[model samples]
Target: MPMPGKYSLQPALITVADQIGFLKQFFSNCFRKGFEWTEFFRQAYNVGYRSTGIIALTGFILGFVLTLQSEPTMKQFGATSMISGMVSISVMREIGPVIVALICAGKISSSIGAELGSMNVTEQIDAMEVSGANPMQYLVVTRILACTIMIPLLTIFADVIALLGGFTATNLGGAMNPWLYFYKATTALEFADVIPSFIKTILFGFTIGFVGCYKGFHSNRGTESVGIAANSAVVTASVWIIIIDAIVVQFTNMFVYA
Candidate 1:
């Protein structure tokens, strides 16, 4: 048998394990039942509409900054003409996807965490339980489902804006001859690059939603826990994105080879 001290912390560990199990079950149930469309629309609006300005601005800056930064390098390579194609490729394949994910993790995850944490601390969740409602279904399912549905849309929108930014930035050197820039950018892109990227973002959305809800739902340390939940949500969501991305790349490559 374990020592008394060793066994003493077992309950806390068990609670954590139980919470993880609950999350998995919650996720399964949400997918199975199909989430509420009305609630989903509301939550999606919250996650997407509320954050539109930021995502657009970020995309714009990302495109502009990337072009500006690459101009000198491409010129050094004596390949200044490659700048538009290169920037568009980067934006669509990686920068737009990853950066938008990070931003959503920061903005949406924190908001969800704090909102849920507040509800938890205030006993609103308990009240729902007392009222004979599945709190997880009503709250967790809605937000998670919302993220799943909305993140991809947001990413696509960001990619467009980033491309626009790149176009505007390139115009600084000369009128980038819109037809050539668009053609090169489009021709250089393949389904492999575009499809894999958007697919990865679904998992990214799941991570942000899962971690945010998990932290907040389990946090009960009073008002203080709200802040803790928010902070942990952002941190965990961002970390999980990178870890999952690495795994996804390897796993996807195997499938491609297979």
Candidate 2:
């Protein structure tokens, strides 16, 4: 006879296997017939344009606070003029992408999970299959592709907004030329700093979409499962974001920055 707790890992292992199968299905459906272009564009608009306000606010605050906090330390080191470069590099390389991705993981991921979970519970997904429609293409692929395409663009937008915010914070102490500040910031960023960060944001976006959809689609057939799916999506996506960021940073250090 098996021990009482011997099968504790079974559920986790099953979940991992299920997720892998779902990922495989997603890739397979990507190249299948009946790609939903309209849905894709709609999801893209919802994911990208609708998110600008929060991203802008977050970016501005991030840059402004970072500059203010670093001013004292830089002054002590007689590197006040390097503040713009420092802020730009920090935002472009690490802070901007990771922070924006986390925020999206909370907002976008939860929204997708709740929406899909509700559909699943209401039998809408089943109804679609009965109607001979590809729910995976219309729902999952559109959402996942939209997120994968939009997030990097959003991150770039956030980076620019952050630089402006940093400039605003810099001027609070004294007047500085806008052109000079921007020039310094731009010069501080290099090809190596940008490419890796961009790659990470793309991966972050995909992970966010995949986890959200998977949780929602596989949620139990109950109203309560919708909430659980949304919450789980946020938590799982956030954890994955951090893990991917750590792994990417390590690889970048080994290959790009080395």
Candidate 3:
């Protein structure tokens, strides 16, 4: 008889087979019925409206912290007065979007995962289907759409708050005419930095939302499964964000250098 080997592993092959089947079904539904918008609104409210406060707080303080932390570094370069412009560029191109995304991944992703997991555990999704409802449109589409719409909006708000935070932190360190600080910041901002940062956020938002929904929607366990689902959602979303960010950074550098 042939020796047993890793290629003969049952569980891994079974999982791959299951995922392929799930993908086929998921695509079939997407084409057959398209999607529903009203449910999307409901999920949008939960994902976007509910998480505003935390995003704002994080955005503001992140800006402030970055500015304060960089003072010594700027001073070392003998361009201490250039702090305002540096803060503005940093916040616009990188800090603002990344920080906001991380916050959303923690708050909104976990909430979505737990909510969907609970619905799964209680058989609500099953009942909806039995009642002639499309659970895919009702559950996944709306949630994904809301996240895609709201995350960029949140990123914009975060950019503004972070700039304000940087503004405040700059003044705290030394005396500078307020207008001068803003003037320098205004001049430093280029279309190159601002536009790509904003555009990349849409991808980040979709990735975070998609992974969270996919994980929770497929989760199976008991009532205790809810915890696992939520935890996994946060971890997966965060990991994806970091991975995507690194890739985006490399891509951006290539374009910049070219």
Candidate 4:
């Protein structure tokens, strides 16, 4: 038998290997023969439509606060009129996707983890397995795909609403036409500014879904494991979102900005 100290390090290595295996299986299931369109649509509606209010509110407040904060600096430089463009670029390029994604991580990731954990604990997954239903396809694949589809759309929605919030803020200290504000905002953005950030949200969505599902689906059968799964899912998904954002931004900077 292994020494006590030697065995202590094994769990960490095993966990790392397990995570790698989970990722491979997730990707495989994603392309498996049976595509559950009905479940996908159902999950999409739940993840997307149900998330609108929070996204809108987050985008709005984010823009509102950023505009207010940047105003003093703009006024100091006598560039107050540039507020619209500044706010637009900031929201579209960074704030919108990251903030919305983090929020989704907190809200959707935890929900999915807890839901799956509860199902796992109750042996519902085993029941489904015995009844000829593929839980991985129905639950894991559908939710992951739904998140991947919905997050970018949500980010786009958030960006627009954020710009509207910025416009309102711009008008607070001085009068500016809505058309002029929108035009400035649009003109300030390029395909480069938009595309990479949009791409990041897809990764964010994938990370959120994968982490949540992995935590829940693999949770130990116990009443307390449900809470542990949800909590772990949120924390892990949020870290993955930040890490992915950093890596994507680094690549985008090298290629696009450099």
**For model 3, what is the error of residue 223's alpha carbon versus the real structure, in angstroms, after optimal superposition?**
1.0
The residue-level lDDT of candidate 2 at 174 comes to 100
| Model 2, residue pairs in steric clash | none
**What lDDT tens digits, residue by residue, belong to model 4 across residues 108-201?**
9999999999999999999999999889899999998899989999999999999888888888888989999899889999999999999999
Q: Model 4, 112: alpha-carbon shift in Å?
A: 0.5
Ranking by lDDT: 2, 4, 1, 3
Q: How far off is residue 88 in model 4, in Å?
A: 1.1
TM-scores of all candidate predictions against the true structure: 0.90, 0.98, 0.86, 0.96
lDDT of all predictions: 0.86, 0.96, 0.81, 0.92
Write model 3 residue lDDT over 1-258, tens digit each, in one string.
776586688776875687566556555665666577677787778777887888778888987898889989888999888887888888888878888888888888888888888998999989998999888777876777688889988898887788788888887856778788789887999888877788778878887777677767877968888888889889988888888888887888889645
- For model 3, the superposed segments whose C-alpha errors exceed 4 Å read 1-35, 175-177
Clash numbers, per candidate:
0, 0, 1, 0
- Candidate 1, which segments miss by more than 4 Å at Cα? 1-16, 31-35
* Model 3 local distance difference test score: 0.81
What TM value does model 3 have? 0.86
RMSD of each: 2.6, 1.3, 3.1, 1.4
Superior candidate under lDDT, 2 versus 3 = 2
Indicate whether candidate 1 or candidate 2 has the larger TM-score: 2
Worst 10 residues of 1 by lDDT: 27-36
- By TM-score, the better pick of 2 and 3 is 2
What residue pairs are clashing in model 3? Answer: 40-142
Candidates 1 and 4: which is better by TM-score? 4
